[model samples]
Target: MSLNKETIRVMNVNIYCEYNISEKPPLILIHGYLSSTYTFHRIMSKLSENYSVIAIDLPGFGRSEKSKSFRYSFENYAQLIKEVMDYFHITRVTLVGHSMGGQVSLNVAKFYPEKVSKLILLNSSGYLKRANQLLILSSYLPFFHRYVHYHINKHDVKEELKKVLFNHSLITDEMMEEYKRPLLEKDFPHSLIRLLRHREGDLSSQDLNQIYTPALLIWGKQDEVVPFKVGQKLASELPNANLIAYDQAGHLITEEKPVEVVEQILKFA
Candidate 1:
């Protein structure tokens, strides 16, 4: 069965989410940085046939209202997600996060392991080595930001969108529009700024080994944002974790190969 989308207001933030209940265990799909619940549209529809699926737009993205005053750290986002789960009376869930969302899932698994049944990280950030820190910082500057944003405006947004995507070709005009339309809203930029400022990917090796959750990690072999080696690192650290690498895809594995991604998720579930 297909899930009907819904929205709920919590702490003055509008959270856009879709909930579909079936007999099987519920799945919570979390999108990556600057992404909305729409990222999981295809997967949700397919998985809902047997398993319940709940996909939400994190605060400051998609239909979720950005709280400019709040600090947008991954830890805070995980707390907000915990609150959302409590609001729905959902005790146990399998969290499947893509990119930034994967990082958030790791935070949740760390802080509230009781609530998470399983963890899935797809092209996730947070396992970067010491050497890559400098390169990531360079992209945070205003000059580069303006250059990137300018190109996004000049080329139907898809041109700039492709940069963050692992599989650039899958970033179609339609996908670009879906991702861009909400970003044009007045508060989006500030929210994005807060997200960047608060992003910290310094998870300790000790902590990584502590996550005993059944985890599945997927990475695009050509992922430019989080290298394939990072996935290998994550798989090594996480106990009972399996890693899958997609050779032809980029960072946006969900968009590039939705069918295979969903199939892998089902097998893991």
Candidate 2:
């Protein structure tokens, strides 16, 4: 598929996105924290064959603007997504979100049900509380962003990738390069601090129940980041949902099992 890349101004922030033309309802792919549209590269081409796939880099991550002024909460992110749909003249979409992106997708489905046709979450972060009080308090410190940069700078990209992927063999130089790309930006750390301070806790069970949209929850049984049990809980709480587990997969199920992920998305959406 020929992917078209563009940067559109939404809500005063320049948002970066990649899309392929198709006649079917669009598929909006949202990546996890510290990730970009690259996370969905494996499935983008194939998925675009059936649906117009629009993969985005949420503010503060990927190629999108890392504005210090942008509200880094899920609600704001959901609103930005809605504006994106309007920009593209898309009426409805199948939201495919992974990890933090999944939480953002949940927010969209919960608040803008009319704009969503289906919801698919991959090892999505759910029912988690916000940052600890101590961390929130420290965020007020003038130089806290530098500390955040220091902490993240200390970790090797390859090791970090290992923590998210069950199949370490998939780790390649290209993967490390893409994962580390955002870290090179001087403004990224500041935006991350703003995110930690502004991000609210995940949606509660009451909130999830309100969303009656058809949902599919795909979990990586070996996922240590967001355990498979979370998926089980989500399935139980989401009024209309189905849960599928891949025993050999980890948090980065999109990378580990893209073929199966596409199959499930096609069957469900």
Which one is best on TM-score? 2
TM-score of 2: 0.98
Candidate 1 lands at a TM-score of: 0.86
The segments of candidate 2 whose C-alpha lies over 4 angstroms from its true place after superposition are none
Query: Tens digits of per-residue lDDT for model 1 on 1-269?
Result: 65778888765577888998656788888998768887787677888876778899998888888777766777888887888888777898899999889988998999999999899898988754333556447656766555545543555567656766665656666787798887677667667666666766646678889999999998889888888888998899987799999887888787777899889988997
Can you write out model 2's per-residue Cα lDDT over 1-269, one digit (the tens) per residue? 78999998999998999998568878999999999999999999999889988999999999999998999999999998899899888989889999999999999998899999999999999999999989999989998888999988999999999999999999999999999999989999988998998899999999999999999999899999999999999999999999999988999999999999999999998
Stretches of candidate 1 above 4 Å error?
128-156, 164-169
lDDT of 2: 0.93
TM-scores, all candidates, are 0.86, 0.98
**Residue 54 CA error for candidate 1 (Å)?**
0.7
